[model samples]
Target: MFRTAVGAVGLLAALAAVPPASAESNSDYSVLIISRERLEVATSCEIGVYLNDQLSGRVFQEQSTSFNLPPGPVDVRLRLLPGQMPGCAAGIEDQRSTRLNLQAGQINKYRIAMGHNGLELRRASLGY
Candidate 1:
């Protein structure tokens, strides 16, 4: 009887060492849609969109893209297209990032625009 009790305790300990299921299992996700507003500058270059330090999508002028992400803090970045051209601003090597805390089952909208330093993301209205 003592041996059976000890074995049961060992089994419980082993189970406890295992990690729980991923947050994706029982967690909700947020729908993020990023829109690239049409600007007179750099109309020819396709902007690169990064999520969590990874390239997620490429956006064109007046284009919109969507991503479904788990509820948490997300890192978003934008990369300007390489090379210089007329009407396009120089300095395509600078990178900018924004931290967003998203909620589950919520829709988040953003607009990417050309700033003095680089590309920036701003919370936008629904119709924008």
Candidate 2:
């Protein structure tokens, strides 16, 4: 009985030393914040946000979205999504993508704006 108790205690101690499998850490990821709060674009269309060519999220006027991406280069493409608005049809705007190098534990912000060419992302400050 004493030997079984000792073994159980040893097993309990070993289990306590190991980290829980569900205890995930976000330190390896970076945050990307895209905001459309500025009136520079002046459009009622919802903007489609693509990560590596995959449609991830959407943002409208005075709105924003954030993504937790892994550390590396991410291809961010912005396009006006077809919606209820008459002028929000697809293929009405440029489809250029911007490549951003994201670092771990860093937060990068950008504001959608209408550049000379078309819709583009401009580096923005931390707050709106």
Candidate 3:
């Protein structure tokens, strides 16, 4: 009888120690950005992607890093950082920025010519 009581107490403790299930509505969405002509590695260009006129994140092709952004409308702007300044800005007549229109759980990508090195902003087409 004592062993049974001990077992019952242990069982009760174990049950109490169990973690409760979480009740959270997970946001299901993801996106990935790639250059139009494929950005070269070890370059000085800095790619800045914005979402809904908001700053999402910047990507340096030299150091491969993932930009974590929630699924939604994103406005992307590609610019050459201070170091990659001349090539992206100098002589290049077209460095226009681009505005991206995306939805939840969708991947909106933007492509630009390496020559046009200004700020070409355009509306994102959710084609694929």
Scored by Cα lDDT, where does model 1 land? Answer: 0.81
lDDT computed for candidate 2: 0.92
Off by over 4 Å in 2: 1-19
Q: List the candidate numbers ranked by lDDT, top first.
A: 2, 1, 3
lDDT of 3 by residue, 1-128 (tens): 99999999999999999999985433455565554334533356665554454556665653323344666555555554444456644333343445455556555454443443544433335465
Pairs of residues at least 3 apart in sequence or in different chains that clash in candidate 1: none
Q: What TM-score does structure 2 among the candidates reach?
A: 0.80
Residue runs of model 1 more than 4 Å from their true location after superposition: 1-27, 83-92
The candidate scoring highest on TM-score is 2
Taking the tens digit of each residue's C-alpha lDDT, what string does model 1 give over 1-128? 99999999999999999998866633478989998765633567777789999989988778889999989999999886554545445464666589999998888999887778777887888873
What C-alpha lDDT, on a 0 to 100 scale, does residue 61 get in candidate 1? 79
Backbone clashes, each candidate: 0, 0, 15
Give the lDDT of residue 67 in candidate 2: 97
